[model samples]
Target: MRTLVVYESMFGNTAAVAAAIARALGSTDAVRLELADDRPAIGDAELVIVGSPTHGFALPSRLSRRAARAQGADASATARAGVREWLGGLAAVRADSAPFAATFDVRQAPGAVGAPSHRVRRRLDGLGFRTIGEPASFRVGPTAGPLLDGELDRAAAWAEGLRGLAR
Candidate 1:
């Protein structure tokens, strides 16, 4: 199946997780990995995965992005709107042929509240996309981090599990 993985990263941790997930699902030829800033078309996607870093108990706001950038986040990281803005197109989804979607978010730690995955899942579901599973979260070490050791491996495993739902 053709899969699309869209991610918004403030400190690059979310980008790494998105790349790992796309790689796990298949080769680049079969999986399209895009940054939320790119505002990629959801065209022909059989499986769509969206991920972003959690902020203020939900998706990052413009103010949050600005704050992150001020705190040593790369300028490129906040160059444009992130996941919250990109997901606005959810309204364009056609119920008759919407794809299956799953959401993920990078958090400060495990069991942390305010993960954006919940809101993302709600949006996708309201827009008529069939959700194959609950949203997933990956932990990051400090605020700006190297993903807490084996998080990438765990992300890949989580992505591999999503493939089963496509069948």
Candidate 2:
């Protein structure tokens, strides 16, 4: 099955998670990992997996926020446009009834940090992708991450499960 893994990373933690997922998918010939800016075409792939590191308030990174802002004149417009764009992207893909999976890599912080995965999963569902499971988070250190032990393995297993769903 052709699979595409698209992700955004603030540091390298999210990138590491993306790479591990791609590796677990096994063989580069079958799975491709691309940065979100690369704008990869997933039209031929059987599965498309998207990931992002949870940032402020469990939202996407500042870059994404900036893009959202540029697309709109105000915070409300930014929110609407961001949601629309995200949904539209999913819709374009889902028009073909293709399956998709998503995960969020977030720092484990105390108290009520926003869970970006909730928003991501909702958007994916809105696009008509059958959600096979919940999103996963990987811990980050003060600088970035070597990742908390076992996080990479957990991410791999998640990717493996996603692969199974695609098949």
Candidate 3:
């Protein structure tokens, strides 16, 4: 099935996760990887997967920050707006009948902290995605992640599982 893995990355950890997901989909021809700004066409694809690295509790980094700051938005507002804009771009093509999923990648912290996955999942659900599964996270290092053992394999496996949800 056709699939698109769209993602936002800060220190490249998230990009690695996106790549792993795309690889597990096993569709060299049908899968595509895109920076969130490229606004990939998901119309023909049977699945659309959106991912981002967590920043400031529930925000996405880099482009989302710039997009928000340019408009003088706060962290929370920026995140909400960014996700909305990203999904809005797909609205013209994404079939209301088709299914979609969302996930996030976060750095491994030493103690308990907030996770942005639930917020992302809620946003995707609001956009009418089927909410196929719980959001997933890949551990990252303080700088340039040593990726906490097994995260990449876990991401690939998660992607493989997600494939079953495709319609």
Clashing pairs in 1: 57-114
Task: Give Cα-based local distance difference scores for all models.
Answer: 0.86, 0.64, 0.65
Show model 1 residue runs off by greater than 4 Å. Answer: none
Candidate 1 residue-wise lDDT, 62-149, digit = tens: 9988889888899966646878998985565788888889999999967847779988988888888888876899998888997888
Q: Which portions of model 3 show Cα errors greater than 4 Å?
A: 27-29, 61-85, 88-96, 110-113
Instruction: List the candidate numbers ranked by lDDT, top first.
Output: 1, 3, 2
Encode model 3's per-residue lDDT on 1-167: one tens digit a residue.
77778776555677788888888886543787877766666656667777776656655655556653564434332332334357556553244565566566555664325566667677667767666766787787654466887999999888888776654
Off by over 4 Å in 2: 61-90, 94-96, 110-113
Clashing pairs in 3: none
For model 3, the run of ten residues with the poorest summed lDDT: 75-84
TM-score against truth, every candidate: 0.94, 0.74, 0.75
TM-score of 1: 0.94
CA-RMSD of model 1: 1.5
> Weakest 10 consecutive residues, lDDT, candidate 1?
88-97
lDDT (tens digit, per residue) of candidate 2 on 16-85: 8889889988664388887765556666766777776655655564466665355442453223222224
